[model samples]
Target: MAKRENIGLSRELRQTENRAEEEAWQTLRLLRKEGWPVRRQHQIGPYIVDFAITKARLVIEVDGGIHREQEVAARDVEREGVLRADGWNVLRVSAQFARHGDHLIEMVRAEIKRCCPLTLHPSPQGERGT
Candidate 1:
């Protein structure tokens, strides 16, 4: 019961986060064609990720200006600590994915290839495997 409530509250917070991270992920999603699985506003237990590829050990965090503030920064650092302990490497990007488009996709692809090359597959004939 308590866990369900926690999950509900966490989802609500994630909804808020989605509005904040909108721009960053639209650009980032292109990496999916490149073979990295991208999940938008994904939840892990109580924490919600802005973008994550679990098997790749990569997490893309889109930081709005609000995250730069001292209090929020501290919390984010703590959040990173917890995530790191769980074996996910974090990458922070700006809010441009939604604004500009597809820029972060290549960046995230490079990071995943660098961090977890074993999971990458070569795309053929300009199509990603379904």
Candidate 2:
């Protein structure tokens, strides 16, 4: 539960991500390149989320088939509740849906826009303007 342990666990999770997570990560990487400060296997409080946009207080979870089980679903609900209580918006994407990288990007973009629209805009000279 310590910060050091969370960092180690996050590193392991990043290295051993499932296929769906990998697909989502690829799309998230694109978002990062576009100036969205996205992080993978990011830790939030005591939980390690699949992806997080810290500035937007958003956490994105790619739910696999195992999440369909009743027990896992219940736990997920509890987790989401805790995150929501802490002012973090949770977005759950099915593993099947994550396979579509374009759709995943769009979903994340919409969530970010809805929660925290980017303040910076590009100027005509390719510089960032507030």
TM-score of each: 0.73, 0.87
Candidate 1 CA-lDDT value:
0.69
Tell me the deviation in Å of residue 37 in model 1: 2.3
lDDT of 1 by residue, 22-53 (tens): 65655666666665557766666567777787
The residue pairs found clashing in candidate 1 are 23-98, 27-102
Backbone steric clashes in candidate 1, count: 2
lDDT of 2 by residue, 1-130 (tens): 9989999999999999999999888888787565676788988889999998776788999999899999999999999999999999999999999989989999988888888765453222222221
Worst 10 residues of 2 by lDDT: 121-130
Give the Å shift of residue 102 in candidate 1: 3.8
Off by over 4 Å in 1: 1-3, 6-20, 96-98, 122-130
List the pairs of residues colliding in candidate 2. none
Residue 84, model 1, lDDT: 88
